[model samples]
Target: MKHSGSILIVDDNPDILIAARLLLKQHYQRVKTTDNPFDIAGIINEQRNSDQPIDVILLDMNFSQDSISGKEGFYWLKKIIEQDANIVVLLMTAYGDIQLAVDAIKAGASDFIAKPWQNEQLLGAVAAAFSHAKDKQQVGKLTRQKQGLNQALNTPNFKFLGQSNAMQQVFSTIEKAAQTDANILITGESGTGKELTAHAIHQASMRHNQTFMSLDMGAVAQNLFESELFGHKKGAFTDAKADRIGKFELAQGGSLFLDELGNLPLEHQAKLLAALQNRQVTPIGGSKTIDIDIRLICATNDNLEQAVAEGRFRQDLLYRINTVEIRLPALREHSDDIPLLADYYLNHFAQKYKRNLTITTHDMASLCHYSWPGNVRELAHAIERAVILSEGENLDVSSVVGNITSNANSTNNPIENNNAYDTFDLDILEQRTVRAALTHYQGNVSHAAKALGLTRGAMYRRLEKYGL
Candidate 1:
């Protein structure tokens, strides 16, 4: 089924408002009616507060038969555009004032609708307005992505710096995904360079010159989710001091990187689904709906399938976002890349901390032996710490990675980790280990239980015993 956007009919005449609503009702999910020009602003504010934006405005040009200049309507239209430049405004004009209609267009009217309108013409104009809005949005999204990519590519930190087959495959994947507008879902443990991948994708796209904004979904508040994503009108809420634009609107011609997407609430999932489907957004407390043109790239450590099964996320939304899923291997799974990544980080830290440290064979072995639970992020931090704290030219392996290898060897089997299981004193050490791992990974039972060599469901039952 075709997605129907919301429409607003603004006319002083009740008959005209009724007619417009009836005509638009067939195409739009909602058709708001307002006869008073004075109440138009309030009506818009109401919609914005509700997180529903008015997609297209069918505004009557002339108000009060005594005032045929359309001065009031024109003034409001100008005000509306000043507030939101992307709104689709269709002017309604009486017959024989073709010059006025032309002037309205010049003054920011999207398209003019003649009085005593034909159904086809009105619908055609509305459809054209939607098309125009979408085109404008796409152009804006490209512009932003282009700016972000240019900045990222110009940075000295963008070199992939690897010779491994895994790294080679990642480079190839980045190159392939960059050339298209497909929605990308990147999954891996945190600190696995997902943001770097997103930036690389943006730089590789045709929109490398536009703005690229990244939003951390986990950081946003649940109650403020809609306002942050769609935007809000001034006076829409207590803290909505002015008309606020959402990420979708700001990312108008660029790529929108939604980091930690799995953490978003179900309410937000519905809103996100709507925006991606329609490519438009409404600000909080404001009546005008702005079009958005953005390539979306989402990243998360959480498994969305598990989220769906647990009813924490919507399945349909998952289908929409996972059009092109790229599962990134963790550092442990791709151990062959450790030496390469470590060398890159070592050199980076050595230069940054003004140290002349060199990695010895012993140092390399220590790094390769340890399991990096925190992935590339943990390794980078460890390297920086080592560089800052080391004294001589040769990197200090003992000081840098104290006990990392030793700890791994000792805890290779969860059942053998006497210290970790000491608190529980359980009859089943394996089950207790799985529960502890689940708790540590925050309900990511699969990943948590993986550390203990158990299946997800097995870990789930053990976690249940601990009242998790």
Candidate 2:
């Protein structure tokens, strides 16, 4: 996280390499330059063995001298990923070769900065990439602590299932963003698979082999948030019996997912922004700042923009963390996928509960009509609950709570019916209703406002009111 850290600049052109080194020298204490892509592996190995692995690599994906569709760059990138997947690799490309940049990302490059890049963009990417690497290392440490030193190392390929459009979109975004150091902000209502999205992003990223750390900002106490995120030195405070690495330091070269970010206090947000901003963490009661590299992903049930407007969250911080924003649709929006989700959860819990039951038409009708207030998470829990309590071969709706029905009149679209709110939270129900309108019109605020029977200003006020 230190601005004075080391960077290795690799480019085929002496001019470009020199320029890169000079550009980095402003922030980095030691900037190593190498114009030969062929020598990259040797240089990286030597650095790794010396325990001073280059903190960042400014690499040109195409070498003019040894061009065969970037064979040279590809070889080095593969080798680097194989040697140490935790390295922060920022790929450089010429202006008209964006397709090649995308290919490099798929091949494991951490990020891509084009030729003729702005100084601020390059430095910002470097800083963010380095922080991502440090965070992965920190998460690895936590995984080691939670299980064993070899736990993450021994894990096999991950399994995440969902063919829903939202899930597919989520997967594609993660695939594209994982190779880069871009910060991700996932927004969704409670139970809409935000954590799962975070997990998928990490699993598909270059740091897939490392640890994945997650914590809910809303659940942690304000006083404990600091020590929890940034480790404390031994005897730093009461009950600080031994040294501990916080999540930021523990998730180095991996990912740290902050769930319910809207719940994070302003103080915690400041510290997080600083760690992200400076790429360095000052642990509680520790004078020395630890350099860290981390990929950050934050999820929230509350609307962050409103939080920023209300002065509860930092606007600059939001810009920093939300390079890519993914909004997850609630269960009702994608009701067509309910049967699939329900079947999946049913099979999952049925296996766990040792039940050989199947859902019936009546049960499916009940589920489809029930306006799932809890989204996927709630549905999964309901299925598991039903699985455990079922007494027959066919699962029914009686095991689950809440109203689910069979009549078309009973299943009237909440957006078109006022009666749907009879048994639901008016605030959330209204928000969902308005959000549906916004979606139906592709975010045309005025049209959505008209469809929802409100003025445009009223609609905006509601969004601001609910932080939607």
* Number of the top TM-score candidate: 1
Tens-digit lDDT string for candidate 2 (1-468): 337566888887788887777777878777888888777778878877877777778887677654546656677778777877777788776743767778878988878787788989988999998898888778867766755532453342223556778677777877888888789999876667888888877777777766688888766878888888998888988989988889998898778899878778888788889899999998888999989888899988677788789998999999999999888888788787888888888888888888998999877877787665556766776777778878889876565443333443444545335456654668658766875665565444545677888875697677554333
| Per-residue lDDT of candidate 1, residues 340-453 (tens digit) | 887888888788877888888877887888766556766777777778878878877557455554345766434435465434446346544553564477444446767877
Which portions of model 2 show Cα errors greater than 4 Å? 1-159, 402-468
Provide TM-scores for the models: 0.59, 0.57
Please give me the total number of clashing residue pairs in predicted model 2: 32
Q: Predicted candidate 2: what Cα RMSD to the true structure?
A: 18.0
